[model samples]
Target chain A: MDFSSKLLEQAVDEVSQLPGIGKRTALRLVLHLLKQPESQTVQLSEALLNLRKNIKLCENCFNISDTQLCEICANTSRNSEIVCVVEDIRDVMAIENTNQYRGLYHVLGGKISPMDGIGPSQLTIKPLIDKVQAGKVEELIFALSSTLEGDTTNFYIFKQIERLEVKTSTIARGISVGDELEYADEITLGRSITNRIPFENSLKN
Target chain B: MDFSSKLLEQAVDEVSQLPGIGKRTALRLVLHLLKQPESQTVQLSEALLNLRKNIKLCENCFNISDTQLCEICANTSRNSEIVCVVEDIRDVMAIENTNQYRGLYHVLGGKISPMDGIGPSQLTIKPLIDKVQAGKVEELIFALSSTLEGDTTNFYIFKQIERLEVKTSTIARGISVGDELEYADEITLGRSITNRIPFENSLKN
Candidate 1:
């Protein structure tokens, strides 16, 4: 759409570059910013720039952090030997929110997606291999999504450290806790049966 | 959710301040930015800041513009006597998209909603009255939204300039073109019937 203001057009253009926002939504957002006090726009712009300029990445886990090590990696109480491998920080946050996991995390930054031109080299797969090869981590949990890219990345990592003594396991996949088995997909229902644990093991959890 | 990184938390907080974005979506957007090259983040930040800093408002109509006068107000071919008064730039864009109107516009910036602490004084209402008082505009079109706030604003503006010689009209509202009559809301259907125009006028479009 043609804009009377070049500034508005440019703002809309840049905002539309984000993942889910389209031109119309970007225009609406920009216009909303314009209606507010100029200080609001300044605060938003400054916040965005400051975060990009000063943000630090954790040296060990490759997670976005304010220091050399992330909060999880820096904490002494959390089990450093048990690391949960994730595709990104969002997964880390999701797992942390559940409060069931008390181990360190290894954020791969992204998964390997050949269709998107992203390879294992583009991610932190090398650092993860190096970490596992050192025999420091006792158990490495693969907590990536169940998509094709996630599977590909997990398989590639598993192959690299197959010789290592570390016990590697992927997160369980089945019908959600409250979901009915009848409505579940065939693959999920079949997998749930094949991977079923003993009644005592289920009761323990 | 507790963030491993303070910078990530700050960015998420700022991004979540946007109209539709919540914490989870904000975190997702921030992580997506981190995955991309740092230059992408810089570009996004700079675009947002530069637009807010350098933008100009049109002198004639108070619409967002890159020059002293907006495109429509500056165009000599368009009818200066016919002015379309709208609530904001989005309305200007919506009407412009139709390619139906050749008139200029006056953007009020917002409707006068007391619940939102918005009053006529907070808007460009005074400037609009001054523009009409100049006796240059022959007709004024009220193209605000069809809401209580919109109607109140329109009525207020109408009362302010009732003594003027200008002809005033509002955009038509009814069941949309090709929309089923049964599904249309009661108020809209009733208004469509009460304000029915000549059958030939409907065919003219």
Candidate 2:
């Protein structure tokens, strides 16, 4: 597209480089910014710069942090004996929103996807094994997505620490609470049926 | 959402302030940037800052520009006597993409919408009239959307410059080139039928 100003063109190009934004949407966003007060743009730019320049990752869990340890890893009241392994910080936020888990977490960075050239070596798998070898963790919970890559990563990590004293388990797969049986996918509905718990046990939640 | 790092949270909040972005999408974008090298984020942030700080609008047409007059206004070959008035720069880009219409443009910045507290005084309508009153323009083309506000803005500007010895016309409305008649809306079909041109004239393109 022919932009009247080189500066506007450069900014639109940069914004459109993001994952889902297209050139037209980028132009709309940039034009909206132009219509706003100058201070709004300043704050936006400064926030991004400060994040890239000053952000750090937790040494123990590899989650984003402002210091050596993340907030969850640094907290004393949370259970340190159980570690829920997730693919990224987004999973951390999702699990936290549920308010169901009280244990600490370990971010694997991503699942093992050979098709994408991301292997166990590229993630924090070794660090997780080292944590398990230290013997502080009594239970390791696999909380990755239900995709094939998630299962592969889970099995790979389980094998690495299998002989260790840690008891490993995966989050359950079942029909969501509000979903109808007919709407459920075959795999999920089948698992929910085969692994159906005793009626009284299901009432605890 | 709970962000372990304050810097990351701030960046996400800033990004989510854009028109269509939400908190989760903002977090995903921020994490994507974090995974990339530092220089990429730096370039993104700097581009936004530079654009907001250095950008200027054209003096004659009120379109975005780097100099006193925009490129179109400064071009010698384009007909300055014929002007196509639009709501904003997006419309200018849309018309330019068609590769027709060799006339210059006047961007009104926005249409007259009382619900949004926008009126003729809030737009560049006066400067457009000034252009016509200068006695150089021979034809004025209205190329706004067909919404209520677009029509209102078109008529408001038309009354302001009607006394001048210039011909005025709006861009034609009709069923799109590839669309079937059955799928076309009633108002559009009615207008297209009532405003039908000679069959030979339709073949000129």
Candidate 3:
């Protein structure tokens, strides 16, 4: 049977645009929302809209924030002398939820992927270098994934920071493999970050 | 671990509120968006906001719309003589995707459920009755499910329409059960709707 209304079609079309949500999943979501009270549906819409509109990246660490500097970067109570460098904001959150790290964060935006045409210049490495050279920092923790790209990024960052006389470390590798940070549970990621080891000179096993 | 930033915590807390997303899923989604080009992440945020801000329900059918009347109601090619009654807007879209039915629709908003305190008066049933009485409709198709609530709703609607002269019928049963209309595949739902049976007055089985 044909949908007699365009209004319903439009809602489904919009919902299907989300990641991993197909036409069928979008249909289910839209139908579920329609069954809810008007107020509740409105809240969902408002929350989704707010997720994008009200939040931004902190200029200091590049983590998502509602202000200029993300709360992690802005909090004075956090360790100002040690910065935990990560590939994305989610890493910052995972680490934060564990309450293990009190230091600040610097989001690399992404790892070095030459196949994807993402090189050293494309990342936020310059800011990290600058933050290190500006002094006060005694140790920099590398919270990157254990993927090939992540290893390459770690080596590249090590080369960049070696000239500055600061120590560099990376999150332990035993808990992760490949480009799979998205699937790592919080406890595993947390343990990896807490047990970070000194960055080695080579990328080989 | 204690979060270094309260803002990051707040954002994660907000993301967890979305349907089917737990804290870990929320973190993954948030981090994925963070790694994307700023423009793409910003676009997703804007889309979410627009979904809530711009889309409103059609005053007549309560289907989501960007305008006063949904596209189906405004279309001139659709037949105004028959109106298919459904439980929600999802049913409307399901029928539409078949490209079969060429008539209008009446969304009941929900099936009757005494446990949930949803009676006929709580739904758009009154509006449907009014629309039928005022229009030139010849057939009223009940596309509701065969669940207990659906049966009660169909019986109530049948009683009300008995006074009118329109040819009323319900979609075939024995095809689905246990409030399963929402789960029916489009083909099954479409076929059942096409092979609707007349409402029998006696329990002759």
Q: Give the number of the best model, judged by DockQ.
A: 2
Off by over 4 Å in 2: none
Of the two candidates 1 and 2, the one with more favorable DockQ, higher being better, is 2
Model 1 ranges with Cα > 4 A deviation: none
Give the alpha carbon lDDT tens digit for every residue of A85-155 in model 1: 99877788789889889999998878898899998888888988888888889999999988888898999
Sorted into a CAPRI-style docking class, model 3 comes out as incorrect
lDDT of candidates 1 onward, in order: 0.87, 0.92, 0.72
lDDT, candidate 1, B50-88, per-residue tens:
777788889888888889998888999999999999988
Instruction: By lDDT, rank the candidates, best first.
Output: 2, 1, 3
Return the TM-score for chain B, candidate 2.
Answer: 0.95
Q: What TM-score is obtained for chain B in each of the predicted models?
A: 0.97, 0.95, 0.72
Q: Write the per-residue lDDT of candidate 2 for residues B17-130, one digit (tens) a residue.
A: 999999988998999998889888889889989999998888888899889999999999999999999988888888998988799999999999999999889899988898
DockQ score of each predicted structure, in the order shown:
0.71, 0.87, 0.18
- Docking quality class, candidate 1: medium
